[model samples]
Target: METCGSMSPYWVKLNASNCFIGIINNVDCPENTTGLESSTVNLQLTAFAFMITQIPFSVVFGLALQDTENTFLLLCGGCSILVFLLFPISGILAFAGCMLILRDYPDLERGWSFDLCLASSILILIEIIITLIVTTVMGIRSSKRKSNGKPEESVEGKGSSKDGDTQTQSNSYGHSIMKFAQVAITNGAEAAKNAIGMK
Candidate 1:
């Protein structure tokens, strides 16, 4: 970045490899002795490191989802929590680091590297949101299936119980009718014999 201040062209440049910001002035430029703090640079570097590490981790996670065995998928699920936490945190840290860098060096312009990192952080955040939504939907669907299955089983059981009760009631009614008929027949025969003897 260059700025013309009525006398000389001031230039600001960043060296990413060495983590240095350099300023150049052709005529009558004030010297700034203060340099970027080590902690700020470390924070920025850590963010990039995490972004890099997530690449292989993400690939493995995708592969684990396709695996038929539950062990790998279960392990990935535990590790995924940590990965999810780190992504947003790292992105925020990177953004904070860039802001601090710009604050300390007002002449510096955010270059292509900053733009790229910003874009990457945004994309990663979006991916995280999508992943969460899908996981939640899948969980809700599975719960629905389980709930639906239980009611069907209960309904079948109720139908079977009703049928059994109807069968038992019919059998008892038939036995009671037969016992009544037998008692009436015996009383009639006795009354007839008594009448004949009296006559």
Candidate 2:
């Protein structure tokens, strides 16, 4: 009896197990006999790990969509890139493991297990492509929204500054008028005193 991680879908786990079993059953080489088990185990572990990592990413992406926060979006993008990097690594691991298992029997017929794995790999790649596109589009839209909002704020700021300038000018004019009135009163008192002295 073989055990699979609970995180992976049952069908995927079943198909992956079948593929490994198919490879191990057909090859008669001594090295394959010794190494095939470990390689297959590693392949399964890698697939499970990939699936496990996606769960949190899926949750984060969903939140990003609702909240539309750039921080969340950025995190999701980083995760997408990381996952994109992992695809090739996982592919290479799968290829190496399969090759190691089937090196002795090049002519062996790959049955349904191979077909399943191939189809799943292609679908996974397509999914990754779609995810990257969506994340980029979302990020672009978020930036556009921010840009659209900035001009309105700037306009309001300009209006407030103009009002402040008008108030400052009015205050300065009032002060000057008051000073001129005081000087005129002083001159009038002096002129009246001079006229009285002459009389």
lDDT of each: 0.62, 0.56
Query: Candidate 1 regions off by >4 Å?
Result: 1-36, 122-199
* Candidate 1: residue 25 lDDT (0-100): 23
Per-residue lDDT of 25 in model 2:
42
lDDT of 2: 0.56
CA RMSD of all predictions: 10.0, 9.6
Each model's TM-score? 0.45, 0.45
Pairing residues by index, what is the TM-score of model 1? 0.45
lDDT of 1 by residue, 1-199 (tens): 0011111222224333323332222223235533345665566667767666677788878878888977888888568657857877777766666566667667655444445555665666677789889999999999999999988998999999999999999989998999989889899899999999999
* Prediction 2 TM-score vs. true: 0.45
